[model samples]
Every structure is written in C-alpha cells, then in structure tokens.
Target: MDRLDIIREDETLEDLQINGFSVIQKKEGFRFGMDAVLLANFAKLKKRDEVVDLCSGTGIIPFVIMAKNSISKITGVEIQDEMVEMANRTARYNNVNDKAYFVNGDLKDKDLIKTLGKVDVVTVNPPYKLKDSGLINLDDRNSIARHEICCTLKDVVEAASILLKDKGRFYMVHRPERIADIICEMRSYNIEPKLIKIVHPSIKKRANLILIEGQKNGGKFLKWDTALYVYDENGQYTEDMNRIYYKRDDDNE
Candidate 1:
C-alpha cells in the first residue's frame, strides 16, 4: 500500500493536517489537491444541509464543509481507492468521521447511488480538460483528474440530477468556454441553472472559469452576473476575494 503524506498549508489550513492528502491513480488516472478547497469555498454551504460532493478527491470538500458548517452531513463519492483512503484519514483527523464518508466508484455508475440516498444539494468541481483538446499528461493520476476520461460534463450534471431531490441544488465550477454546453445540459435534465458567477484572473483579462448553481426541477428563470476580478493588475488578491477566502470584512470599522 502507498503511504500518505500530510499537505501543510499556510493561511488556509494552518495546522489542520491533511494526513491522507495526495494524488491517486486509478484505472482512469491523477488529480490535484487544491481542487478540494476551490470547490469547498464555492459550495455556499448552509446549516443542516444535506450535501454531497461528487468526484470528491481526498475528501477535501467534505472536510471543508464540516469545518464551516458543523450541522451539515456530507457524503463524498470518489472512484479512486487511494483518494478514499486519504479522505478517511483526514476525516478522522478532523474529527468529522461520522459526518462525512467516501465511497469508491465512478460518478456515472447507477448501483452506487443506492448507498448515498438523496441529498439536498450536490457539488462537483469536475474534470475540466477535454481528452483530445489538450496534451495528455503522461502521469495517470494527473491526467484523469483534469481531463474528462470517465465522466464528461454532461454526465456529471446528470449524476447530480439523479442524486438530488426535487428542488435540490447543484453547484459546480467549469471552464468558461463550456458555459453554453453546461446551460444546455442542465436544462435538458430539468435542472434549471439559476445562479452563475464568472471567474476571472484579473479585471483586465477575460473569464477562464465560472461557478454555476442550479436547482433540480426548477423554473426557467436564469439569474447570473460576473464575480468580478479576483486579482489586481499587480497579480495580488482583490478586495472581494480577500473577504471571501479569508472571511474578513476589511471594510468594517
């Protein structure tokens, strides 16, 4: 068995140990560690909410959810055994073992859904790279985590649809280029894309990513706008981003 290592962070986690935080290689391939935190912060978690994070790696999103919202319970679905193992360790370390657990299986599998039941909300920071669109990473773990090998964007939205209850919410992040495809896919599944926030590197550059929120079996009313510049021209974090990730109100007295 491959032993896991802890991922120490500076401002984000501080001493919070990610005992099992590492890349995992499965039949499909590798993924990144930071994807967890990105999705965690994007989920807009609420109290006592039943949340499920699909394609959860190292259980980062679930752990983050636990930290921010103690009353919510999370179930993470990960296809890789190694990732699940690490999430288990992290869960124990964080003392949210009972609140969150991981299951090993592809997100597209039908049989696996029975165990998780239905959730009030589902979040996925799914694979963004197209298999043939970009150079394939020789590393299996890295390749699969970024590229759409096992599940495409449509497949992810479909899975989220099935996993959620009627009117349940689905939140996710994807490449800005695929915004049209995302809107079409969600609408086809009766999951109305209600909220959207376009993510950009700086105020000067075009958007590269977008955070979208949809509700299952919802009306066709779409609501969205830009999240604004995350960084300044000097490449430093902007005021809004600082308030978000750091949870600080710099404008406060």
Candidate 2:
C-alpha cells in the first residue's frame, strides 16, 4: 500500500481526480461537507494568489482551490490543533506543502491577524449557528465548528477585513437566515457586499445557504447571481450542480 493509504487508516481521503487533489478528513468529528466544497467552488481565486481561509477546518477550502488554481500560497487559520495537523499532513501528502499551510490560531487574535499581513482573497466557512440561539453539538469539535463558540459572525468578518488588501475580495458561505447580519457586518468594516448567490436544496424548498462576496473599500453595489439548486425534481444533481461539483478546470481558468 502507498504511504497515504497506510496513513489514512484513521481518516478518509477524498480524491478529486480533476487535479489529483485529495483531502484527508477525520473518520469522525467535524468532517467537511458540501458547504466547504461549495465555498471552494464559489470563491474566485486566480493564479499565484495569496489566499487565506479562516475557520479552515482541515483546510478543505484551500486544498480544493489549489487543486484547480496555481496559487502562490494559501494559509488556513484554524483554531483546532488536530484539524491544523491533519491539514498540514494532507498538504504534504498532496505535494502542496510549499504552496499551502495550516496554522493553529484564533482568528479573533489581533496578533495572529498581524502576522498574516495582507492577502489577495479571504474565504470563510464560519460557524453558522449563533451561540444561545440553538442547541449545541455534543461533540467538542463539532460544537466549535458549527456554533459560534470560539468566534462570532462579527469576529469572522472583522478578521477577513483585516487580512485583505485594499479592494481585496472576501468570500463566505453562510446560512441564509443570517444574510442581513452578514451584509451588515461586512459593510461595517468597509467590505462592501458585491455579489451573492442563494443555494437551494431543491426547487421545492427554500434556500438554506448563501454564497456571498465583498470587496474591501469597494462601492455599494450588490449583484445577485442566478440561484443554484442542488437537486432537480428526480432527486439528482442539476446541470449547474454537476458543473459546480465537477467543473474544476473550467471555472479555474
């Protein structure tokens, strides 16, 4: 067996054959889901771009983007030590250690923010559930990942604002219920909300996810892209969804 196979005993390696990119996720506890994939695909990254992913669980966002884009460097800031270690291992296994890195640090820390300096793009798949609003997950990892246990919505947006260069783009995937909150928080920091896409599970249901982008110090104009439906009537992926899932090369170019 290959070294990856041997090391993957306690984890599951998801292979994206498009660019030979793989992400190693824990067998249990805080595994990435479709949200991370959507955010990666949703984010607009260019070649040799300096990117940062906040609340980057296992570095899925950076790994997925690096697979398709020729990024100069991408750093993932995660609060969880285990996730950071796992992400670094995945980076090495994928032969992208030089271009990708994972650091264990709280995004709310100004010191950590200063060390990162400026970046071309900032992406976040932040905790969607507000603290004290809903039931918290029993698992410690999942609790921190899903709920605003470590950081709140404002904190995530502020971190992104601090990390971005002037006119730098910030992309995030969040629950639809918090769209107003997201827009407000972003605008409060001079990160103008410029683009948005609503994601629906099916045509019959309401949108549950919002993929939004803002430009630091940008003008106040919001463009709403066509809505995305994950499934068609027969419970299969829609054409756009298929393109989203598999259009690794086309979108990157």
Candidate 3:
C-alpha cells in the first residue's frame, strides 16, 4: 500500500505552496493558521542549527521552517498524540523524516525536557487565552490549542528558556494584548526580548497579533520593526505580507 493512501478519512494533505511542501491537516480539529506562517517567517534560523518547537500543533512551524531554511534538524514537541503522529507522517510525506521528527510529551515534563536536550532555537505558537479568561472551545482538541488549559504563558516561556542554549533565539506569535505579560515572562526566565513586530489587519485597524524574538542570556535592547499590515486599503494582501507567505526567497536575499 502507498504511504499517501494511509491518510485517514478525516485528514487531508494541504500544500504549503511557498516551498512545495504539504502537511496533513485534520478536517475538524485544531488546524494551522496564518499565525504559524507568520511565526515561521519571523524566526531566524541557521542552516546547521538545531531547533525545537514547543506546542507544535500538527508541526506547522517545523514544516514551514524546514521548507524555507536548510536547518540541520527540528524536533516538534507536542502534547497531543494525534498531532504528533500527523507531524511525523508529514515528515515522511515530505521525505524529511530524518531531519524533522515529532515527540509526544508535555512541555512541562522533566523527562520530556531531558529528552529534548539543548537547542539553538525554540519556536512556539502557544495557546493565546488564559485557561478561564475567554469563551473556551467546546472541542477538547480545539480548547487545548486555544486556551491555556494545559500550559500557561509562563510555562511556554520557561520551557523555551530551558531548551535554548546561551544566546539562542526564542520566537513566538501571540495575541497583542498579552505583550506585557509575554515580555515579563521572557525576562523572568532570563530570555531577553530582542525583537518584536506587530501584525495589523490594515493600516487603520488595531493590531491583533505580535511576533516576538527573545534571546537566552542576551542583552536588554529591543528592536521594533515597522508595523506589518496584512491588508491594504484595497483589501488585498500587502506586498510585505505576500512576501512572507509566498515569496519567501525574495526576502531572504
């Protein structure tokens, strides 16, 4: 039997398009969004560096980063068993199983931490809402992915700090409202906030998402890039946004 044929009825392969990579996505459960793409784009990865992605739902960050950069290895740590299997299957489908692997374990587990070891970079798209702060999703999978039921903001930051080597970068995408808390968590864990970029729907709209990069045991200077507008007045994707999602190489050069 062919490997592609093993895809379940509830799952479908979606093309990333930018780098000719495809990921298996479920029909109803937690799905990768533009935030994953933005986080991958926001992260700066080296060709020979090791990377670990925490809360790697379906391993979108790993897949997208591997597609765009020539990284040595990437391990996606996910608590969800189904998502871990799907991420591993995606590595097989992309013929990058040796370079990209998925591990099923909670980020806070000490044994899991030992299994991960240290890495040059840690990227995460963690649950944005506090456990009881917002309207929780009825679906268990969605709920865990959206709310901090299993792990809170501090948990994610600390995990990243523990996994990253000195001066290693930690990249994340989160709700703009949590910027203050996010920065505080990073600093408390000794991960210095180095860069931040705001994502806005349009020029006139308030920002909704923020991309941040912190370095473990690094300096205190924080650099803010120009605000990124997803759409223009005409409602079409901005050229900058287009380059991030589609024309990745155009900006890499």
Candidate 4:
C-alpha cells in the first residue's frame, strides 16, 4: 500500500521529530503525551534486548525507544484494535516492522502473555486514575486511556512481572499521588523498585509526575535520581527537557 493509503480520514500523521519517524494519531482519540515520552526516556536497555510496552497507545513508547536504542525487538500491547492497526501502519511507514510491532490484545490475557514469552524490558504508561475516582471522559477511547476502566494498576504490574525475564527491567511513568500504590504493586510482583525520579512542572511547583524503574527478581535497594524540572522559572523548556524531546543536540551542551 502507498504511504497515503495507510492513514485514515479521521487520523492525522504527526511527526515524531526523531529520525524522520511519524505516527498516526486519531484527531479526537487518545494521543501520545509527554508522560509517555518521559517514560520511554527513563528506560535503560541493553543492545539486542527485547522490550514490551503495556497499554501502548499508538505505540509511542516503542517508537520513541526505537529512535534511541538498538534493541533486537520491541512489541506494544494495546487493547484497542484501532490503535493497534494505526500503530502497525506507522511501523510499516518507518520500515521498522522487522524490529517493532504492536499487538491487539489485552495485557491481562493469559494466552497473550504466553505468546509473548519472556522479554528483557517492559515499560508501561498505564491509566493513572481509578475508574471511579475522577470525572471520566465521555469518549470511550479517552476514558479507557485516562481511567482504569479496563486494566488497573495492579494488572499492569502483574503482566509486566509475568512477561519479564529474570532480572529484567521495568519502567513506568505515573502520577506522584500514586507512588505508594505503584511501589506496593511492584514489590508484590517481585519487581523491586531500583530507581526513581520525580518530575516537576517547574522548580516552584510540587512534583506532579514520577518516573520509576524496577528490576524483576532483583535487589531491595532504591536510589532517587536528580529531580527533573520540565520548565525553567522563565517558563522556557529546560535543557534536559529539550534534549529529551530531541529539540537540542547533546554536543551543543
């Protein structure tokens, strides 16, 4: 199929701004956010490591990792069929299908988990709010992406644990208010929390997001990295933020 044929009427092709990669995003449905970008950056992977991303909306996390890492394979598990189709088309557009793909199946499905087998790394940017906690979006897609209508926090952690190889790494980005719940779930599945970084909108603001990394069947020690401020006091993107977004070159610093 031609490149234009891959996109649908309701979808827009947005530039990822990395290695000439772009993604197909629904104009009104759930789209990639800064949290997903931050989570992808927070993950550390070895060469040839296989990675899986749970709740991979539009496969953004997987694509972001592909831009930065030389991993053997990366799979994105998304429950939404439309998202899976769009993501696969984007993969073909980038000619990265040999190394990256998206699966249209629930992460909590046992059969899907069996098919995936073991992977070296698992990353998730799961729904941060409980189903009943906040005002849910009227759109079913947005609601599922923002609230735990399908998979809860525990479910995400358990799936990651089951899919990970021994000592495999797990990375996630979530709201700071849920830090306690995240730690509890990770530990319950033997995914030890090893590193954490709080993300603040600015220096004066309290942290609203957190980036966490864990290891399966690993140690008990945890280390806190330097806090990340997205913007400077002058309301400009911080140097670190600019680098993460690929807006600045490392050599220039």
Candidate 5:
C-alpha cells in the first residue's frame, strides 16, 4: 500500500529517527510522548522474546522496541480503531508488518486477552490521571488517552498479568504520585516490582514520572536505578536524555 494512501487528512507521519521507522499520528489527538519513549528504553527484551503492548497508542512502544531489538514478534493492542489502523499501515509502510502489527481490541476484554495468549514481555504507557481527578479533554480521543475513562490502573496491571508468561517481564511508565497504587496492583496480580526509575524535569525539580519493571512470579527484591533528568539547569536536554533520544553516538548507553 502507498504510504500516502494510509494517512488521513488530519494525521501526519512522524519519523522515529531509528531504523527508518515512522508512526502515523493524528495532528490534534494524543500523540506519542517522551514518557512512551522512556518506557520503551527502560524495557530490556531478549532477542527471541515476544511482546504485547497494552494501551498501545499509535503503536509507538512496539515500533521502538522492534527498532532496537530483534524480538520474535511484537503486537500492539489499542482500543481506538483509528489508531490501530494507522499503526498497522505505518508498520506496512516501514516494511516491518510481518514482525510488528496492531490489533483493534480493548485490553480489558476477556476474549481478546485469551486470544492474545501468553507473551514474554508486556509494556504499557497507560493513562496517568484518574477519570475525574483532572479536567477531561474536550476531544474523546484525547480524553481516553489521558484519563482512565476506558481503563483504570488496576485494569492495566491485570491485563499485563494475564498476557505475560511465567517469569515474563512487564514495563510501565506512569505518574510518580501513583507509585503506591501501582505497586499494590502489580503485587496483587503476582507481578513483583523489580526495578524503579524516577524521571525529573531537571535536577532541582521533583520527579514527575516513574518507570517500573516487574517480573511475573519472580522474587520480592526491588532495585532502584539512578534517577533520570530530562533537562539541565539551563533548560537543555541532559546527556542521559540525549542518549535516550539517540542524539549522540553512544545511543546504547
């Protein structure tokens, strides 16, 4: 299919700057952000592992992982049919459809979850705000992407637990304020928190985002990695942030 034929008038194709990969995104809707990028980077996957990404907006997490790792296969589960169609087209346009794809299904659906079966890894960049906690977006797409209108934190953790194989890994990026709730939900589903990393806007500011890695049916020990700062005192991207974005030669760092 022609790349131009797949993108709608309201959408644009954005380059991921890795392996010539690009994703189709709505111009005004919920586009992929640094939080998604950070979670993709935080996840460590084996070469032969299969992955399922829940709440996979525009399939960015799967594309990022595919670009960085030679995983067996990766599928993105998105509730929005528009996003899923666009993501699948993006995958075909990039000529990686055989190994990467998106499904238009809700992560909370029991039948859909059963169809997905078990996977080696699961990743999610779920909605960070509670349904009624913040001012909901006027657009339905943006509202569902930013708030827990379709699924809550517990829903996300439960879906991940069901999708993962024994000793499989689960990775997520969420607001730091919900750390306690996140841990509780993961443990309740038998997903033990293994690693935690805090992301700050700058050295002087408090953490705004948190990245967590959990293993299904694993040990209870949890390790804290060094905090990541997005910007320096002068409001410039930090070296670590630059590395994550592949701005330097040491991108693997």
Candidate 6:
C-alpha cells in the first residue's frame, strides 16, 4: 500500500502533507482554490436537481455547490480509491455524507454509468493533455492529475454524455488551445456546447483556459469573458482578483 503524508489537521478538514495526491492537493499542485471557486461561483444551480461531479478529487466542488444551493443530491466519482476515501471523509466531516456519496471507479466504465443512472448536471476538471504532452512528474499522483494518464478529455465527455439525461448539462474546464477538438468531440456525442468563456491571466495575456457548459440537446452559442488576472508581471494576483477572492456570496444577504 502507498503511504500518505499528513502535514496538518484542523477539527474537520485535513491537509495532504506531501504533494502525493495532486488530484485533491492540499498544499501544492492544483489545490481546489481559484479554478474550483471560479467554476463553482459561476455555476447556476437549479432546485430539485441532481449533480454529478466527475473526477471529484477531495469533493471540494460538490461541497461548495451544496453550500450555495439546495439541490436534490450530489454524487462524486473519483478514479483513485484513496481520493474517494478522502472525499468520503470530507463528506462525513461536513455532515453531508448522507446527502452525497463518493465512489471509486473509472468514468469510462459504462456499467458504472448505468448503475448511477442519469444526472441533471455533470462537472469535471479533467487532465490537461495526452499524458506525455508535457513533462511528466516523478510523483505518480501529480503526473496522473496533470496529464491524461488515466483518461483523456474525450473519455470524460463520452462518459458524461452517457451519464446525463436528454437535456442534461455538462460543465468543464480545459486548455483554450484545444477548443476546436473539444467542440468536435462534444458534438459527436450529441452534447452541444451551449456556452463558453475563455479565462485569461490578464487583459494583456491571451486566453489560457476555456470554461464551457454543454447541453445534451442544445445548440452552439459561445459567450466569452475576461476572468482572473493572477499576475501583473510582478507575480501577484491583480486587484480584481483580490475582490473575487475576498468577496462573500452576495446571494447570502
């Protein structure tokens, strides 16, 4: 069995001490901070709807969604057993274990989709590339999380198409360079790219990431926006980001 490192723990949430679990990353690689928050905050949840978050690392996305909306139920699927276990623990700690379930399984597995049936919405922060598209990490977890070692974008989209209903929604984040391929793939699966927004680091920089919402039976329409400037050449989050990061939920009031 692979051993895990624990850096610290509060009463509820625990941090992954080592950078082993890049998927759920507590400290290092791709922690569920800006990207996750941006997606969750941008999401418009519907009442009495079910959401399935594919590749739901530490269950942070679902947790945030549940906090903001009153949905029917939320389900999380993670390919890694350790990640599933950790997410289950997070559910328990948050007292939402009964409302959500984390299962360890592959999205490409058809049987798993049949058992879970259809969902209203599905979200994913999938692996970026063709595994070796970039330099692979020495650590196994980080490598898989960053690269498409386990499943590719096509796999995620196909699985989501199978898991969603006729008009179900699929939300995802991916590199902007692959825009054409992603649209082609989604359309092939009968999932139309209903809306899309390209995320840029700054007004000066070109788009880096694409955030999209696809519907099972909807047509093509793209909406682009300039979001999140992480640096101003001096390597600090720009002023707009400060407001986004620190601002509380306006709907709360």
TM-score of each: 0.83, 0.94, 0.94, 0.95, 0.95, 0.81
CA lDDT of every candidate: 0.72, 0.89, 0.91, 0.91, 0.91, 0.73
Model 5 CA deviation exceeding 4 Å by range = 137-139, 249-253
Off by over 4 Å in 3: 135-139, 247-253
- lDDT for position 83 in model 2: 91
TM-score rank, highest first?
4, 5, 3, 2, 1, 6
Off by over 4 Å in 1: 1-38, 137-139, 247-253
Please give the lDDT score for candidate 2. 0.89
Candidate 2, 1-253: lDDT as tens digits: 3546535667898786657888888777678889888989999988868999999989989988988788889999999998999999888888889889999999999889979989999999999998887777545889899889999999999999999999999999999989989999999999999999999999999999999999999998999999999887877788887786775334433
Per-residue lDDT, model 5, residue 69, is 86
> How does model 6 score by TM-score?
0.81
Displacement of residue 232 (Cα, Å) in model 2 is 0.4
Worst 10 residues of 6 by lDDT: 15-24
After superposition, which runs of candidate 6 have C-alpha atoms over 4 Å from their true positions? 1-30, 137-139, 225-253
Could you say which candidate leads in lDDT?
Answer: 4
For each candidate, C-alpha RMSD in Å?
5.4, 3.5, 3.1, 2.3, 2.5, 6.3
Clashes of each: 4, 1, 0, 0, 0, 1
Error (Å) of candidate 2 at residue 57 is: 0.6
Clashing pairs in 1: 29-141, 30-140, 30-141, 30-142
- Lowest lDDT block of 10, candidate 3: 244-253
Better of 1 and 6 by TM-score: 1
| Candidate 3 local distance difference test against the native | 0.91
